[model samples]
Target chain A: MSLTLVLVQTLNGLQLGVLLFLIAAGLTLVFGVMDFINLAHGVQYMVGAYFAAWFTAMTGSFFVGLALALPSALLLGLLLEILVFRHLYGRDHLAQVLATFGVILFLNEAVRILWGAAPLSVPVPEILSGSIVLMPGLLYPVYRIAIIVAGLLIAVLLYFLVSHTRAGMLVRAGATHPRMVSALGVDIRRLFTLVFGFGAMLAGFAGIMIAPILSVEPGMGDQILILAFVVIVIGGIGSIRGAFVAALLIGLVDTLGRSFSGDLLRLVMSPAEASQTGRAIAPMLIYVLMAAVLFFRPAGLFPAAR
Target chain B: MSDLVSSASTSDVPATPRLRGTVALLVPAAIFLAFALAPLLVHAGLDPFYLSIVVRIMIFAIAAVSLDLILGFGGLVSFGHAAFLGIGAYAVGILASHGAGDAFLQLPVALFASAVFAFLTGWISLRTKGVHFIMITLAFAQMAYFMMTSLSAYGGDDGMTLWTRSTVAGSKVLGDTTAFYYACLGALILSYAICRCLVVSRFGRVLRGAKENAVRMEAIGFDPFRFRLVAYVVSGMICGLAGFLLANHTEYVSPAYMAWQRSGELLIMVILGGLGTLHGAIIGATAFLFLEEWLAGFTEHWRIVFGPLLVLVAIFMERGILGAVTRRRR
Candidate 1:
């Protein structure tokens, strides 16, 4: 609607976009490098939030909680890879999907048992608790701004690491040709483990960052995981740049669609009908965008060379 | 037992003459026979509640068999199959709410809607192979789910209840629980036969050949995509039939009928029973639902036990329960 509302919603969209990027970056990489589908990847995000919540409560500092959660998340990822995912790499996609789905079930239920079904909330740190005025009348939460900034910084860091570094080159090589990379004497198994762990940590980091804003719940990651899948699919599987671009595109489209669809519909229809149709259409905008994208380019926006 | 062994091993080892005549007919006949006798057993002093459960199993078995057509035989791995189920149910619900409660009318509408959906989405989805196909199907299913949720005129997120069961040729025979059970059983039998015929026909062979090697199938003067698309549409129609039965069985329709989780469960059922075998899907539907029911009897947190068990099945029961049974016989 108005300029102020648009500005605030834009910020909200950016925040969601960054969170998606964090999760999708890891997802795309794992998918690209290993050709494995990890449905339980979302659980890592959930675990990260729970770890942040529990650790923050114990340590009495958000920063301390994050520091603890990151490594723990990484460890959990490694444990799962060693126990479950390692066997699935040699199997078919159906097997991988079913196995990981089992992991999701176990983890979601485990989280419920550990921390009852009630949603756990994390308080925003005192320093970033209040809203800061952007323009004359626009004010936004400082913590959200912090999340956006942090996400952007990580994206920049990821871009540099993926494009410039030696390990990054190996990753890129693995994505395009894993068998070739393995044949070249690189330890592809270890590389997969490393990538898988790092991706889990990144997803966990997203969870930890968003903990203060969103309710940390058992299945919270499931919905976001679907959104992240949409991001990767639209962006192109296995492309970080694609994930980043698509994540932002989806985030903005989804947020702005929800915010403005009613008003836009009212231009043609009665207010009541507009609101009802808008409510239905808003949640579907991203999927429509995804379908449209796939219809034109089945491989996605940035198909990683394979 | 001879018929069961013959049917179970017939398609699996078609290369050998000894196995060719057996035609895995026994298991399915046995399965249907057991289904037919289940209600009698309930009358003979078993829990009457179980008859309803078997009816539910048969309803899902139809959905699972439909999924197996594409997933196992066609190798399409459609992750949105539940959407067709929901479409079928919603068609029934919407029609009945508007005072049209005839099975003859609802069945055609459900099948037609599902076929249209499958054709359009399959046209797009079949373009991409592997994981892209899976994700796209899921996204489309989610779109359908959201669309259903947005239909505030028809209950929206909370779902809607059907006031009465659909009438068959203006007869309210389906109103009785036993009659409903028999109706569902008849529907499942019809669906199974349709799928069985399709999987064994020239069309089914093309689908199987394409699944094994699409390039080879293409080189042999067959268009794999067209075959796959047709198979996808047929599969959707059958799943929609299951949805129709489901609406009648529960007399309720909700957006939850097509959730991605339900789609996942359908995949599990197909895999659990053994993919590519129509009767295996029936066995899987029975096993999965029974397992859930048996586990739930212990505690509400049944998934905690069921989850790891699924992982074990994926790891150890690679061929599924039917495969396991057949292999042991060999």
Candidate 2:
């Protein structure tokens, strides 16, 4: 409503955007490279948060918890790839979807059994615990800002890793022309495992970073998984740049829409009807955005050259 | 042995044509026969609750059959199929709330609403291919889910309960447990017949051709998109009918009816029965619901077992229960 509130909401949206980017980055890359649709990707995010919550409580240090969670997440991803996902690479997308969905069900329930149904909380470390004044009468949580910064840093680092290095070259090549990459005698299998593991680690990192602020709970990833799917679809399945752009776009649009739709609708209709309609329309804004984008550009904004 | 397995598992081109033909016809007939006689079994003191479960199975089987029209035969993996189900359920709920509790009125409205929704979403969704299509459908379904949740006038997130079942021409036939069971069975039979006919017709051939090779189908002077859209609409209508039955059976309607997870379960049903087989969808719905019910009785956290079982099915049971049965017989 007010300028300060709008500013705070925008920052909140950015934080959400970065977190989405972290999750979508791994998802899109795995999708692009392996052409494997891992529905369990969201569960990996949930697992990361669970690991962080458990470790943070055990170690009594957030940093140490993060350090441990990252590898654990990576190892879990690799183990899945080796056990369940590897066999699925040759199967159709439907099989991949079904298999991963099973993984989601398993992991979600397993976490519930392990951690119980109640949501777990991670205390904000003392260094990043307080709110900072952004401007006059505008204060924001430092932890959220840190998430945004961390996400951006990862994005930059991912950019360098994907675009500048030899492995990045292979990944890019794999995305565009996988058979060609394989024909050139690259160990496509190893590359797939690495990409799958790395993507899991990135998603895990996102989970670990956001755990302090958000409730670490079972099935938390399901909703965000849908949001991240919207991100990758809007971004173009295999394009990291597309995922980044789309993630921020969705984040901003979703946050701003939820916050402003009622006020905006009030100008055109009665306050009561506007509020009701706005409430109905706000949660659907991102989906509408996605449908419109796909309708106009079926392959998305930046379709990877396949 | 590996070659034999591969040959048997090739669902599209069955290795034993005559055997498969007989099995396909017999499976549906046997399934329907069991359904038809299920009420008698309940009447004979086999637990009336079991009849309710079968009724639920028939309702979901209708949904699964409709989904197989697109997912199995047409190769359009619509992850939002549950939206139509919710639309149908909500139609009954909303109309019933306003005192329009006639079966004739509720059925048509539910069917029409689902048709319109399917047409619009499918038109956009079919523009993309493969994974994009899947995600787009999911997004649209989420939109539907959110819309339903926002309807505070209609119970919102908590959903609403129907006071009584819909009256058939002002008669309370549906209120009777046996009559309702027959009604659901009759609807499932009718839906199965319609979908089975569609899949075998020339129209179905075009749909299947598109799945095999869209470019080739296009080159052969058919517009795959138009056929797919029509199929999508028909499929939506049937699933809506299922939703109508689901509401009547459960005496409730909620936003949860259209959740993405429900859509996923629908997909699982289609896949679990055996893709591209109408009867398989029915078998799948039965198998899935029975498994869930059976597992739930053992412990509260049954998904721990069911989840891994699904993974094994995906990894091992490529052709589902139907395929497994046929393979074993061979």
Candidate 3:
């Protein structure tokens, strides 16, 4: 209800939005280019968290761990592409969903096997730890602000890569009309591999970034993966700009709804009833938002040309 | 059963039955008869544990058979069918908690709750095709799950335990394992028969035609939406009945009943037995449950092995167990 609290929540929402954008970007691209739904995309995010945790523990340096984690995540993505996803490209969406689901089961268990089921935490870097006052009586975590900044930079970079690069054009084409791209003599398979790999790395990067704050545990990606899917669906399946905008919107809505639903409901109902009803509705707000969005724009906002 | 139902629903199939068609039908009938005898096995000094397991399998089999109604027969791959089961289970839990322990009362409420949910969600979800439909159904199910988690009074995340199973005409027969097993078997057979009848009906043909080619079906004067919505509701009702039995069978109900993972499991069962073949849902559910039971006996990390097995099935075993059985008959 207070301005400072709202401001903090907004910033938190933005940070969460950034993470979702990173994950959604990869998923949308893989979906757009190859018409494949990689349910295991979330597992790649989980893998990045585990790999970063392992490397940080081994090297005793957070930055070094990140430095090593990126390429390894990319390799992991491409390797999965070759091993499981490649064969699924021409198959139906059901097949893709099932296979990727298998990948999730395998990876989640593999992580549990390698690292016990107990939640693991990576400490925030000393330099990024603590809070800064954004206004009178309003202090926010410096690490979260850094996450927002980093996420925005990636957004700008992604915008540039998609709009200005030849590879980006191909990706766009793949989403809109893969057959046309095929007719134009480009190796569509290799292009899909590139896009899929890049998407995997982006998800990995998000996982590594968030490991400090959220519990890095098995199956953590499952919920976020669904959220990312919601983001892409609201933004329009193949549209990066849609993903960015929708991710932020979803982030803000979900966070603010959770924090303010009780207060908002109290205006019309008794305190106890309001609070209980608000609590129930908070978790469902995003899904409600998605349903409303789809009602108006069945294909999502900023639908691809295809 | 969806595989067979789909054939029954679609008109393009040649009138001539395949040489193995009788064998395929017989295989599932044999399986059902064998399942019905599970309680007998227990009474004859075989482990009663197996009866409980088979009852659980039948309960899931009911849910899976309903799913095949839409997924296999109608070509609507709903990823949230478990929500219906959850709704049905919750219906029993809520009513029983309030003192309505009668099967007649619980079954109607469960079916009504699930049917209404299916009506609302299906109305919205059926508007989209393919991947969007899957995601939308999944989203709705998750919404239901979150709602369940927020229900602080009804045991919330911990779930609720029934003091007694549902009564049939004021009789306590359901409290016995053999009685419960027969109840479940009866429900499964009735559902299978209803689904088969629906598939062969004219309305079902329209749903099938739409699945095959909506535009063509539309040209033929069918409004695909109405047929699909009806199919979705019918499917939800049957699954809801399963939920009723499940609540009694386990004497427990939780939000976990509607988890997306359970939905995934249901889909895998339908696929494993061969999609579109109604009876395959039973086979798939049985195989999947048995595999889980057998594998867990070997190691705590059975999921690691099970995961790869799912992957192998997805990648290579396209026709599933029923398909393999009928193929061999040739």
TM-score of 3: 0.96
Best by lDDT: 2
Among the numbered candidates, top DockQ falls to 2
- State residue B232's C-alpha deviation in candidate 1, in Å: 1.2
Q: What TM-score do all the candidates reach, one by one? A: 0.96, 0.97, 0.96
Each model's iRMS: 1.1, 0.8, 1.1
lDDT digits (tens) for residues B60-112 of candidate 3: 99999999988887999998889998999999999999998998888899998
lDDT of 2 at A51: 98
User: Candidate 2: where is the Cα deviation over 4 Å?
Assistant: B1-10, B14-24
lDDT of 2 by residue, A138-170 (tens): 999998989999999999999999999999999
- lDDT (Cα, tens digit) per residue for candidate 1, span A61-161: 99999999999999999999898888888777888778888899999999999999999999999999999999999999999999999999999999999
How far off is residue A32 in model 3, in Å?
1.4
lDDT tens digits by residue: candidate 1, B119-236:
9999988988888789889989999999999899999998999999899889999999989998889989998888888877889888888888899999999999999999999999
True contact recovery of candidate 2:
0.82
Q: What range of 10 consecutive residues in model 2 chain B has the weakest lDDT sum?
A: B14-23
Give lDDT per model, in order.
0.89, 0.91, 0.87
**What's the lDDT of the predicted structure labeled candidate 2?**
0.91
CAPRI class assigned to model 1: medium
